[model samples]
Target: MFKDLYDVIVVGGGHAGSEAAAAAANLGSKTLLVTMSLQNIAQMSCNPAMGGIAKGQIVREIDALGGYSGIVSDNTAIQFKMLNKSKGPAMWSPRVQSDRMRFAEEWRLMLEGTPNLDFYQEMVKGLIIENGKVLGIRTSLGLEIRSKTVILTNGTFLNGLIHIGEKQFGGGRAGESAAYGITEDLVQAGFEAGRMKTGTPPRVDGRSLDYSKMNEEKGDDVPSKFSYLDSTKPLVHQRSCHMSYTSLEVHNILREGFDRSPMFNGRIKSLGPRYCPSIEDKINRFADKERHQLFVEPEGWKTCEVYVNGFSTSLPEDIQFKALRSVAGFENVKFFRPGYAIEYDYFPPTQLRHTLETKLVEGLYFAGQINGTTGYEEAASQGLMAGINAHLKINEKDPFILKRDEAYIGVLIDDLITKGTEEPYRMFTSRAEYRTLLRQDNADFRLTPMSHAIGLASEKRLRRMEVKKTASAQMVNFFRETSVTHQEANVVLAEKETALITQSDKMFKVFSRPQIDMQDMMKFEKVKEYIATHDLDTEILEQAEVQIKYSGYIDKERNNADKLHRLEDVKIPEDFDYDKIKSLSYEAKEKFKKIRPVTISQASRISGVSPSDISVLLIFMGR
Candidate 1:
């Protein structure tokens, strides 16, 4: 049935594939998304939530760049929260609990409505590569479809093996069939393949749980959204999640099943995410701990199925039931489905360029779990970049690469390609050195203009970003230019229990103090008048407040980033021979040759490359 050649062919329809297909098609490419099951497009295979800590920043960045994840997340949200409100702006993150079924539906609908995008149901078995370049894909039915560029976002379906205690099965997810051939094909084609494991918790019937025994966690009084665009709004009503704990009794019951556990029995040897370990692994690792926390989260607004967060496991079903029964709130819990761990094939991301294209195969790219990343947000961001670069490369346009100071997406890709993750990689705010400059609040300001220039972000999105930028700047300037009297400042200062000012000063001066915030400055008539007259919203006000309060720290980070940019500007010749550098350390030489970093800044970030080694390289480069 396939007649005409396409620009991009995306294999797999999970978070990464969905974004990649959307981005490629939205950039004017004729894109086709081929998956094992079209109904499962963009499924939340693990959790029914998006955005957390650094991940929230990534979702916002995706939205700014015209990807549909943020918009879909906002549309399907059931609960919303701004994490780390008491922390610095850089630490502040927006997260949401979603209606699981709706989340996937929203994504599918968005992709269907997108121009130049098409969907097909099929398993891609192998790529049609010729002379080191990909031409298209060969389906399991032996149909050859042609495309200029191909993106692989196979997620965990690649030769997937699911383990539940001693019993095992060949399924990608609970009922989904495993995908084969592609891994073998790639491995035979000179790609290195590794196995990585990840797990999800059991889903219990919410009606059977006694919520009176647990503590309720509510959403924020005023919820915020993930998308910077005005297309989606924050939740007006929300659902409350419940918190429970696992006791020593519960731990003992779990211990009885250790001999049968796939994790403890070494039935699954691949490493799982370190930060998100299974409940069995947790008790085994932290034996001294009396108990562990577990959150009882509803799967959707109307469904009785509840996800048992922090209780991920691959223990036998009987053990899961017995142990969970001992928990405070789950005494009568009935299982919707038991948790299991899955191991799948992944390629070392060091083989990928910054644009996410494979270094060994021209016009071929890998994203999501195929690149060893764990979270949906991480996968989606990589997909977005891969799609954009694939379109650009085919069109003979410049590739888009976000700098470390620009977005969390940059740190994610750079870390993978440079350091290479042995375990499933996840993003964190602490991972980025210039976190102060890459805050979640200003992602639109940081990325929208660039995306617009690339023909990805729409003109309407660009205008909204520009309006926010101008309004926030005006607000910051208003604080700097307007002065407050001692009487007025003392009223606010005394209320906050801070030292009263003896004389009038710029509102910015008083607001810069640790105790003062935008609200305090808004207490001034002039500040309030400026906001009202300009009709500034909460987003604009928050942006201006962060700029005003954290101006010193922001400037310092900006200068540090600028200093690093000098090294970034020092490009290394692609064909430069690292073996000839006799003075360089053996480890440094190997890393330099393996990663083949395009810039000195990237070279310095490699794990084994020391300061002395950098000095040697700089001297050799005639710096």
Candidate 2:
């Protein structure tokens, strides 16, 4: 049944694979998406939600770069939130609780409508490798498929083993069958593979829970969306999520199953997510604490399925039920399925280049859990970059890489390749030093141009971004050029508990006051008149305000970024002889030779490579 060779073949249908397939196809590469089952495409395997903290920033970045995650999330959301709203703009991230079914369906619709993509339902059992390059994939039924490039986003599926108390099974997820042969083949082919574990909370019946005893959580009154483009509508109404607490009674019951617990009984040796630990782990780790919070999240608008957030476990069914029922709202809860942990194979990302292309095999790329990344946003972002780079690679073009100052996506890929992850890696706002410049509010402003240049972002998106930039610039200019009188400023400044202006001064100065904000400054008749005359929206108004207020910090960070970028420009040949430099430390020499950092900046960031090593390299290259 094989016909012609495809340009790019994506071997998974999870978040990473979906984005990868969409990106390659959108860039004019004829793509094929192979999955074990079509029904589970883009399935929210864990919680039925998208984005939080730094992860929300990543989704926005993905949206800015012509990826479908944001649009999909917007269309599927039952509730929306702007996390850290009281904090600085950089920490404010948009998150949404999605309809579990709708999220997957929207993704399916998006992929089907995409021009150059084709789908196949089959488990990829092995890769068709020749020499040092990937040719395509071999399916479970023994059919071979050919492609110019292969992206393995085989999230938690390669030889996956599931553990639940004393029971164990072979499965990729709760119900899906585990994929085999691929990991074995890759390992035999010189790739180093290790097992990583992750677990999900039991899906409980919503109708069985008691909301009256729990703290009701609602969405923000004003809902914001993910897509910078106007494709998705703003949410007007929203669903409710509830919060409940686990008591000492719950812990006692959970402890009853300790001996049979797979996590503590040595049935699972791999590390689970540190930030999101299982209920059993939490109780054990913080034994002095009286309670732990449990978020009761809905699975879908219509379905009775509910996700027991903060209750991930792999204990026996009886113990799980007993412990959950002891919690406030879960007193009557019943499981759709008990929670379990899955251990799967991953190749340490240090084996890959910054482009996500494997150094061991050309035309081969890895993303998602296969690279040890943990979240949907993290996986999807990596997939988007890998897909873009893969397409660019086949066409003899230089790879597209986002710098650390440019996007959170850049920080993620760089950290993975340069540092290498022993445990599942997660993204946090603290991870990016240039957080001030990479705020979620300005993702489109930062990445749309680059995406457009790569042929992924549309002309319409580019125009939209330009309009925002132009309007914001005009707004900033008006603030700088216009003068506000002491009388005009005092009314606003006095209310904010700040000093009154001595005389008429530029609006920029008034805006720069710590207590005053753009909204406060807008109270002046002249400032209000300028905004009304210009017809600027909140987005433009806010961007201009932040720029004027934090100009000093922004400029300082930008200067530092520029200085570091100088080292980034110092190119080091991939085949450079680090061992020949006897002046370098033995550890530095080994690390430099292993990483083969492409630039002096990258070499400096390597774990064992020190400043003196960089100086030695600088002196060597000086010749």
Native-to-model Cα distance after best TM-score fit, residue 241 in candidate 1, in Å: 0.8
Model 2 C-alpha lDDT per residue in residues 138-179, reported as the tens digit of each score: 998999999999999999999999988999999999889999
- Top candidate by TM-score: 1
Best by the lDDT measure? 1
Give me candidate 2's TM-score against the actual structure: 0.99
Ten-residue region with minimum lDDT total, candidate 1: 518-527
Task: Give me the runs in candidate 2 sitting further than 4 Å from their true place.
Answer: none
